[model samples]
Target: MKKHMKLFSFLLALTVTASSAGCSLSGKKNSSTSSSVLSEDDEGNEGSADGAKADEKKTDGDIRPQDDFYGYVNYATLKDAEIPYGQYGTSVFMDESDESPSEKIVKEIGKSDKKYAPGTNEQLIHDIYAQAISYKDDGTAEKEIMANCDRILNAGNISELMSVYGDLTLNYGSPSIFQFEVMHDYKDSSRYAMYLYPMQSFLGTSLESIHDEISKCEAPNNIARDMFRIQGDDYDTADEKGRQMVYIGMDIANNTDFEGANDMGHLLALEKTSFEEFDSIFSNLDVSLIDVFCADAKSRADGLYVIDRGQCEKINELFTDENLDKWKAYIYSTYISSMGYFIPDSSEILSDYFPKSKEAEDDQAASVVLNYLSKQVSEIYTERYYTPELDKGIHDMFDEIIGSYRELIANADWLSADTRKALRKKLDGIKLITAPEPHKVNAKDAKLVGSSLYESDKALTRKVMDDKLELLSSPMDRMKAMMLSTDVNAQYLPCNTINVTVAIMQPPMFDPKGDHAANLGGLGTVMGHEIGHAFDSNCINFSPEGKYDPSWLGEEDKKILDERADVLTDYYSKYTIMEVFHVDGKLTNGENYADLSGVECVTNILDDKEELKKLFESYAKTWCSLSVDSSGIERLKTDEHSPEKIRVNAVLASNKKFNEVYDIKEGDGMYVAPEERVSRW
Candidate 1:
């Protein structure tokens, strides 16, 4: 199996528009462009539901534009839109135009007879496409993965067990028993440090959930049974193996340290120390599968960091001959999952294990090539579909928004001088990078061979790991990308960078020919939201250059900031989804505040009445969705984002420009009275 990276993005890591916003899925909208700005009520009844419904709208929908902005603009599109087969929800992010360069590139490369020099990107692109078509799922990849599993089971002693785990890490580019990586030091961005991460859980991540889910073990058991059954084991034997792995997973989960090892809260919870401290902390624990600590491999450099002593303690307790078979079964379980879920469709080779919808069936081949060499594919996409005008226009708008933030901070009477300085520093340091920078990867640079897709993927993993490890000795390259240069996503990485990729820079989210109001409302708001992460409740602890520094703000200033943030938490908590679940204010504090601040930032740039209408509509339209109501209910309960309706209504309601432009009065559903408003920056 190819190695998977553990990502770390701060509170507003995944932008709501840049993504499907984690199940707040979207659908296509064909809204009428006619004017729908709110007209004054004729009758004396204000704030009445009847009055709201009577408001004029450009398109037909039951919602009043002022009351439910998201619904008014997107209701028709979402109501009529059908969720495609096998998709849990619908999203605008999923709407790829027919002319998208990714699929075109795949077909073009696959059909090309032109050859390039060895180790060239052109060669890799051509080879990757060929391999995607040549892939054989005939259990070969599974057996290859299982060989590592067998090594774990056959180990006679701790040394041999440790040896296999090391080979898995450094040689085959697989997840190690003790995962470690050399990356930039968060406290000081100039140098890199080796970080020893915590044990990953199989099912549940919470300690209490471990006792609940693992105790039942139904999910993991089914996974094991289904995998075994697909691999030709009898149902009875498969069922037994399933139960055994669950029991093993149960033991592993019990030992997992799950207090604060997540993307949302790592900076506040994780500790850093010297290499000697790391060694001393674990010396008595009897187990430390240190990074690249395989028996025969040599580990260079001395900088090392550990999450805490608890990690080594857990590993020591778990590594024993008595638990060897349990370890093998647990590891083998991952192979079953990979082979079953991601196995290639085969007319003769790898069996297509499950049935898929026609939509997915059509995307299978191109999807394979896209997933196989995503970064390179991103390069191809930019080369074929690069729009310089839109790119420059968006960047110019981003700069204006950053200036607005600066002006807002400088004028904030409540903020102290030190807070203002730190914020301004962060604004200055925020760098924008176009992912898979157009033509940066020369056609003759990166290389891959004419092997199976499985092997080619493994080789690609090694290339990524090679670059990651090389960074330990190299200077911090702020321009180097940390997140996937995905086709339709934007991310705020801890490296103090806002990465905007290829496809997302195009239609729906942005347009070169579109008016400034619409473009700013759509993509500018998204960019501001990412910048807002730098000063949110959680991320404000980090320094200007993205280094963690909780003490940067004065005690008095922090207290005032907390009070301001409290208003958002309380405000959003009152909102409900599916008419049953209430949004968790504290859980969504960072994101809600980001939404409010993001809109405020973008709204600061333009003042025309007509422009404001277009801006607000574009903002609402960007999040238009037809998600399964059940999914929205769950996301409202657990997701950091407010549901789509609340995301539009609540966010716009707080904006002074929105209220002024829409003529939202005291009793209007979209009006938040002056005293009750929350302005968090």
Candidate 2:
């Protein structure tokens, strides 16, 4: 899976016009165009139910455009549109497009009553969906939910609590104290390695944010208390218990040495330690947490773990017997929260505690069904939409984009010979996976079999965990694509690989018959954006061979890149969203830098005046979106990428080519002076 952060722009990360302020999932608008803008009526505009009202849109000459390009192009278009797919952007539309295979499969599954045989992939998919939507007749779902709740309450010690939490994560995909996954060895990106990450409660939010009112804490502690109270506790007791849970969370944040946890630091500062050393350094969490939670990890020939020593040390502080009450309270709260998924009656409580969009609320059952069956659904989608020609087209476009990057790097004046060589080596080594490979559910050890929805879900979870555990001792297969081909997204994995799924390669994003301008604007730009990640600030820690190495860039070259990035930071920091929410320039610099590089790469490949103009228009169109909603406000704080409107406007503002093509003069909405424009490519 792509990391929680550091995603490429497009699909979810990219923008484009919608029917209203929020993004639309389906469209019925016809393609409309102007010399300066591509209207929603253009090709691929089929069923989008988002974007500004056609009557409300001011012609380019009707009004005085602000120097704020994003405001001029995107802000006035706001009309509080509905987010049908629950998310507000191109990603939603891409996933729900008429051509979307997953959507088709979901609809197909929803209309079917065909019984799948046990031990088959279809059966697993059916069971996951049936259980998710509460359509299963058996009482296993209720039992499953209660059983986990019982486990939490039954934990008599901190060690036992840790074990139960791990079980919850391993079997039910619930939140836990720590998270683990099979990832490319940072030291050797070509191979798989197990990575243990501190839970989001520790890393997702800042310390100050964590200390805010219960309303501000991760999910409402008050709700957790309410759930506990409902279980049997009196009001006061439940409230105190909830407070204890909140306090433990706060303490974790307060004691955490959060000085360096940024993208670059995530790669550079963490030290690798053996399991024995891990046991000593964070003894409270070692064998109890790792062994019981992930037995395969303990038995592996390679027992190495990478950790931020400072963070782990603080975690140790919370592990004493003296803090057992707090630990137990937190455990009980999370266990109840986890049960919310299996218990349909708990939806009301879960809704109030956890943030969710209206679409998510209304379509909860359907979304859950599709999500749990993602692998199988993706397979169905791939079978319907994927083709060799489509794959080849995207692959060819990616290669060309790489070639463009090579030319840009070759011409870069600031990079020294050695630094450029290292960069080229990394670029050359990038493994591109453009298609989804074959996937089959292994039902070899599905013990939770029967007519029980809960048992079926438990079995599915166990199977997933088993596969993950197996990866701990297995060799990484370089040829295997990590992401599903049917996924409507693209990514640049830090493993020196770029994955552009076939789903995203469809119309609107990558038109097969479209002119160079449209193709380059959409798909071409995406290719460049992903390639930029290879050399971005966060990814720069790795050498060309994908080994973790900070020496890739010489000191002088690093200074130059840093200075250039500072200019970008300054430029983006000036843009404020939702009035009070300011963009986190440093946090978003990597993606912003990639946006600039992507534009440069695309522009470098085009020479014809008409083609350049279309490319510019297409690029702008790619990021055109309606007004942003409040839900996006939180994203502004933590998301690595800036808003879609900002991505398009900011990147264009920094490009001389864009200025020339659009005829943007000084003081124009889209203009940025040559001296102020920032670019690292």
Candidate 3:
């Protein structure tokens, strides 16, 4: 799957808009007009001037004077306009005010008395519960719910369950596992039917089965299960508990086939035990010493043991003498104090795993040690350096684009005075946040010890769980913090806040010095697209305060909006992917609205400046880069946004300016009959 596909249609609250102070770039004395702008000396041969004139005749009667320049473009270029050539510069930095049309719409919606349907996921749960409740027999609902829960809980053997849970806990941690429970009020008729709850609640009921499975499994580091057993056994030595723990860790580390001494080496050093060791072990049939050594070592210290060769090879691959020396000093200062999770604390044992060289306490040796330590520390560290720069650039770009929109708003002749006033009100409520909040996850804040991998793992897990619980309990606050974090890709809150941080402000989206058209087509379109989301059917009912109300428009107005949306849906449905038809009209309605409206808004903004319109079209060409991926083709079937070709073609078709600039004829692919064209603000 494409990494960014998930983000393709999603709304991000992270967008920053232009200032509300009525800022105008056009008012700047330094800004130049198209007539004075420089131009390339490329030939401009009109192939079918007669055909264009004939086509123009058809729409002449219906064309309003104001609409004549709706998509006009001035091909002139300017010498000092900061136009980029070839691949533009990588980093762009700017500071600007935040103003946006989407924010205004959201704010106006907030004041309205529109009702909101539950989120899709929430609605699914509600529907399931309602179905369960509809049965006349009270036991029927309860029984069905229990049956489904039991099936999920008991689908595999106890050992399999343990393995699955252990893997899940290790990788995703408990919060993700919490997604498997069933909760029901049984009292509230509205919501008492069937709802999913956290999975932790079921662990208690199946603890015995789980333990039995763990006992049967030969692998090591069923980490949580092992810890649970040790705790339950009261740290008993009589049962050889320490040995069992060591065996578990070894089993986990050595399961794969790779060149390492044992499992410990495999897990920590990313190596596997040599085939010779396996052969020798099978022939000797004496594994007691290995088991005892592992167990006793684990009791006092947490050591990630692997064949020395594995660690040696990895060290060679990653470090050089100079780099190693710096790392050694850093590691001793940072991680040497905390070694309980992985290696035994006894000096003799510690020296066996990590020996201190007395010779010069030399930088070379220190470097080696430091290199190893850095690798260990990096596992938990999370910091992105480029986020701030990207955040600043995106915000500046958004501000400029939104400022252009204000001009369009001022010039819109189709909207009624009352509607325009409401539109302005909506624009006023848009909120912008630049970077991710400081409170977001950071490795520096997490206290991790390299000596004991187990201890470090447990500590990290606990920290993450605590964090998740906090987020779940106070979702709004979490959302706020996320918006502030510069590392977050993008976010859009039901609230009017549009947040665009540094994480997603890079690459194909927004390049600081790329062709003006490409940059705008990428991030600029994305910004406008998200803002348009605020006016989707579901969002339209909500007021700026994030409350569901329907006060913004009357029933007749809503019907008109719905009709317009239907037209969009029907039009997009004609597009095909992988031989499958377009997305369900209702399912994709929101994204469709955003696409259409976003294009209209951005295009209108560009129309205010003929030269800018040309620049914008040039930028849009980049978005048309095609891919051969079948899945991408298949996406057209269920994706709300049309293919790039269709998006550009359809939007441009309705653009009178585009027609004039391109000299489109009556039968052109992008031609839209005047009466058939639809317009909505």
Candidate 4:
């Protein structure tokens, strides 16, 4: 699955109402005890009357709020801020959650003298981490990679070439002409479906983007030439080959109908067809490559795949010997790039190609293991930190936030009776998945234990693939947790489910004993934001059954939604980031819409003036972050959500409640005039 599977909005919050007195609680265990827990007593050190004052003084430095709210709230820290080594930014919640738990887990597992139980999740993580730290850069991996490249380059015919292509893609994570995968059917939302789309380059950049860069001038080609030089090519020859390969990428991008700003969101909307129909259009070329990725479903895949007929036809016409040769080079380069760490002289060869981070390869490998074996990590993380009390507190907080959303829908004047009823049903239909389900390891698989790391990792990937292929003929597991409980994030699945990962449930993001005001500001807002996605412009029309059916919305209500959404687009588009790039308001509209609804919902829950003040301050500090200039620009270009600064200030400015709580006067940075402010509620 693509890393973009997580659909998140900007989220932050504070504690509950004052009426819930003495509701002190501790969040998940972390080393930073200073602010991890809160006491409900009046004289408690944190989240007390004095605690709120301390936060105001700590954050609201000398800068005038009217001139710059982000600077005002964040300047004192930003002035002396140091991005953590090997990281772009840090937060109290993020920093505490990141290192302490994972590092501790690794340390504990590493100390074990005996081998972990065979075929258990513990065995998998232990082997992967142990192998990573002890990895020796021998010439063997490079030789294997070169041997595969040679096979592709020396193929005798289209059938032979395509077979080699299939092996690389299915086992080695390389892509040939196109890619195939099994995922939840968008049209049905309750069953698995097969999708075939144009192949994406292994390089971080997409084909269209890479091609555009090469077309600009010789700079991109010169860079590619350097990469090839590292692979043993002389300068001039590498330069020529680099330019030719880029042109090949351009041709593929053009032929695939993904020439400009293409993403899965766009491809999902394109015309879909059965595998038989798709292959008929490409009969001139061998199309059996599809079966290689589909595994056991080879025969059953007859009419299972949904594809873009136009793109397939164009790709079929473009598959000639000359183009195939260029493809070989392209694929070889990408495959080697992916395996750089495993190759000899990998550091020097890849130093210029990949970012320079202070982290060691072993640590990166450990993270990879954690990600791939998230179910295991989730189990360990929960056992050590998650408690029944924290679980109940979080669920209660979620209910409170959802209550606010329900009130908003109940009172929405813009929604007609029919549209409002449909919207409410859709909202009520949303399911909640908060923790990772137990992973049932197969003790019977020999490769699960007493195998080399490389072999074990390969087996794991194949296992995951086989499971997905099996889903092709089975029902979708809608309640399955898609993320590790240890990840510090929440998401709204389009399948009418909200996933609150266990990691994000920890403090300072969501404090149990912390001021309900602060918890409301941080976690409450997050819950509201995630739930708000169901009512966002794109998702508002989805049926209660989770199907994307715009007919659920009345024509008049749809018009109102679009108009309000445009307000958000115009408002956010004007905010500049890094002095050069502006937020892609249109791209970020859905998230921004959620942000508005979230903050508004949280604000509606507040009644006490002092508590409200604390919530506003807590909300602002949650978004307090400083990033490298280059990273900021990259975020503006690629991130669907607005920059952190814009997420804080733009969101605050949109709500009248923020102004009332903070006494944000006319011209204040936090004040958006009534006419300019866009309130989705």
Candidate 5:
């Protein structure tokens, strides 16, 4: 049986009302935190339960609320929760307790019999769903896929194959040897810029994250061989080609800083050069890389923001006649592996050909087809599942959190007058965007027309690329800028706005009929968690104007802020998973800081002890998770956020008010001394 709160007066206490906060939690300081987790989801970005998708989920042993708030409140839920297949973990926010939101959306759309008009959203939505579920293994699908691959990679020389890299990238969703993106400039975050990085290899890039070193180097060869076989190459030829692609891919992976990509300093450490100068990085070749950087982006190229100069130059060494077969094999392997789905029985072929390679690939997702119909699916979701009242309630909660944040910053003792004013300014400017963004979903002329899913997807890919390129010349349009509706996440965009994604507005995260405390603990705290990020060690530097500045904090203020955050870093650093690896507090401090402030911001607005109890339970429920022994161990070694239990316990430990409500004493596992507490915001 589930345990009850300490006192019988708990019911009476729940009746007491409390004020609300106008703040929220947030993402990584420089990038985005996974949106699905209570704070950071990791398994293919599922609300991260961390590592091994448990064959058998494990909840914590019996623990008193005063001793272990996270365990005490979440243990019951975790005991019964099941981790879905292919997902690393599950939580109250996005669980397997009911039908998957994505599957539900797909099924609802697929069930429609009425034919939608071509170019219309309804028609596009239906077609996307139908095509995704159409697992055509017929010879025609494979032929079309092979024909496309051969067309793109059928060049005689290295330069020829390299020339249409843009075409391959823009028209087809093939993973390239190099990744190109139109994004906010490193120095000038205000305007869009074209960024390029040497393609990190399929080996060690996904399925497994490469840390300090790369292991199982030959794994790529096996994968490439399997890919070639499934794509119709003979074993002897496949063996030879697999070896060749691994050779080329290894050269790229060696020089690429995959680990550094996670660091803010490394991310902002961009190398800019003109088109010609950038092209020169590919020495000894007549090829103009700028020509292959995609066409629509050519005119809008502010400058090439090369992320890995060494890797670019290093890969250039491979662009030679001597390595023509190597280049061809590498190109073929990547294209086939990524675009192989066009072939009917692609999944089955891969399973028989190379089952392990299929594990982490995006094409295996059940609602993978829905990605093509994002705008349409979102529109449908809003029409059927959302309400104006829900929208208003979310907006109202955000408003309350914002009010709470204003007071938190206004009263922060360590912050100087200047910093306080600036923080408040950012808080004041923070906007809340709910589901079905304020802007329209689709373009008037945008239409997908193709006999096959592959052909139709080609059109969609080009449209998406064109849309991204158009942003290069345009200022950040916050209205048009939103996360996918199907993603169960809430993000505080670096632009100082909070996104209460439609997917997160469901149960365990938020409910329209939930009592004030439940809402406060669920969605209210999420908003506050995002808003509270402004006070994190790194986010404190985000300008009200929406740019990241390393030097935003004045020297004196910076020192004070670091001193304050150091407490959090030290407190969290003490935590370990399996007692083998410790949490990287320095790497995770920004998120930890946000988690603490997220709670502090929400708790400050509510005063009733009974209501506070409910709010606290709701908050912990969001992070409820079951896992195997190896679960948090891998995450602690790799991820930037604290483990889920740490995210809950550490923050709750620092929550004096919560401690008081539960009558937690110093001996309690959940208690921290007053001086040791670190609620900086």
Candidate 6:
């Protein structure tokens, strides 16, 4: 799967009314406690003093309320309630005594003949299960495994593969496809087995090399040091480093300049020139010294590795003029809709004047919009929950989770001693990139000079790419240029130098006062989800030293994980939006895994008795919202993440900790069978 799979959304909750008479005791309140022993009457009957039921009445089994104020509930409160009860609430729509909102939606969708109509929900659900089962049983599994291996094996060339033979041996062969083996063991153990690999091995160099270079240089005290060199600073001071950093930052900013204003005299002349002319200029340049320095810098970053000229050329080859335009459209749309970065939609102009032979402009437009929306949601979350102080808290939570795995490793009855030792080493080598690295573009110092929007954008893109290329050449160091800017809205780049740029920090995604549930539901989930990617199925195959190693878990444990994932795929497949829902369970499985796991991880931390319940309530409030539009609904079909409603339902369903809080019972509609639940840490 692409690194794009790392981004996603989160949960839902119920409204809190002041009236005691109208409120359903079985709703939000029941899930808030650890005790699950409650009767149907106990479930309902909680209204505020105002006499209005806190739990709004359901119609056609849809728990969503008619009133806009009661439309969507909070995630934190829902989690608080569910964490103790193990269900949404005693009276959730998914309960056996009640039909789920989705089931009702399925019934409604069934009435429509349009492929994308609302009635196809049930079929969509059924199809996802069928597909998942097929993926597991058909030759698809082998094909997928092989394809991934090929991607890695062919990343650079045969020489690179030979250098990482031990790593390749574990994952490359038809018979010894190591990822499958790990999955097999997880299936048997009901526990996750991850194989950690180093990013350097695949990229053909080590991040350590890059890190050493950065260490030799001083750190910058402010953004200026990164932009230009200054005197009187320590060798390791930020000011000295700032000069190189500024150059890279300016390069990216300039490339992004869509307007023509930033174009230099020479660049203008080259713009109208042929590709051959451009190539000539590039070839004549003495970039070797810069490349060497960049390579050194990348080594210092710890997790990043250089993508050699050969690989860069290959990636470049993948970009045709048409594809480049599509990519630009996607980026622009993502900025506008998701990141809330205000950019004019020139689709009208493109559609009217740009030749249709250019590409599928409509598809590009939609994708761009979707990316923007996703990013917008992410920013909302970052603004609400991300802070320097909270960083340590989050890290500590991760440590505790890791500690649990340690205990599990020690006591596992099935694993052989050899496997255990290997697992321990993998655990020890887990590489974590918290927050952005300190060595990215210094936006403050970078000036855009393009005269036209298009020119500026192109210039900025090229500049950014060059800066990144420079970093890739250097050793690994965490770059926070992206994170420090409140304007950045998304993240990408899979190597050791994790890049979180400023483009990801924008609105709809990051409103300080936006409802907590929605903010976290958007960006918080995304951030945590991305962090989870560091240890996702694909990343887990490598070792911390950037080498490929197949020593994470034993065979038995891998099986358990597959079966568990199967359950998730099966369950999500059952969800339908209009009758024509397209839940691509196989394609989305990795994201689903991350979403589920992130919720579990975050919930474990938030559920502590010592934590204030109100904070949980605030978190729950984030997921609350009004209904979406037809276009928004249509987009859900192709989306990798589950719809908001299901995101809450599926996660809470499998959370045993939630069951304890909600008093959810076996055979309840929202209940997940114990044997069917998937747990990966």
Give the number of the best model, judged by TM-score.
5
lDDT of the structure predicted as candidate 1: 0.62
Question: Worst ten-residue run, lDDT, model 4?
Answer: 12-21
lDDT of 1 by residue, 551-666 (tens): 87788998988898887888877665543467788888988888888899989888898898889889987776555445555465457777666777778877888888876775
TM-score of 5: 0.83
lDDT of 1 at 327: 58
Where in model 3 is the C-alpha error above 4 Å? 1-393, 404-419, 440-446, 450-455, 478-491, 511-518, 577-580, 583-585, 607-630, 633-638
TM-score of 3: 0.46
State the TM-score for model 1.
0.81
Q: Global CA lDDT of candidate 5, please?
A: 0.64
Give the poorly placed runs of model 6, Cα more than 4 Å off. Answer: 1-462, 468-472, 475-531, 547-556, 578-582, 605-622, 625-637
For candidate 3, what is the lDDT? 0.37
RMSD of each: 6.9, 8.1, 23.3, 8.7, 9.9, 24.1
Comparison by lDDT, 4 against 6, better one:
4
lDDT of 6 at 156: 41
Would you list the C-alpha lDDT of every candidate in the order shown? 0.62, 0.62, 0.37, 0.63, 0.64, 0.35
Candidate 2 per-residue lDDT, tens place, 1-681, comes to 211111223322222222212122111221221111212222343221234345324543222122333333433332222334554443213223232345446656654699765555456555555554444334566666667777877767667777777777787766566656776676676677676665456222345467544456645567667777647778888877777667667766665544343345664555566667766766775345567667667777455544555656777777777777777677666666655555545445554654445454325545654555676666666677777677777777878888988888888867888878878888888878866566654555234443555566566677677778787678877656777765556778777888877767777678666686789988788888988988777777677666777776788888888888887787877655433456778889889888888889999998886897667656655665532244456577667888776687667767877666555554344456677777868
Which model, 5 or 6, shows the larger TM-score? 5
Give the total clashing residue pairs for model 3: 77
What lDDT would candidate 6 get against the real structure? 0.35
Q: Model 3, range 277-337, lDDT digits (tens) per residue?
A: 4223323222322222112222322222233333223322322333332222222111221
Q: What's the true lDDT of residue 315 in model 2?
A: 70
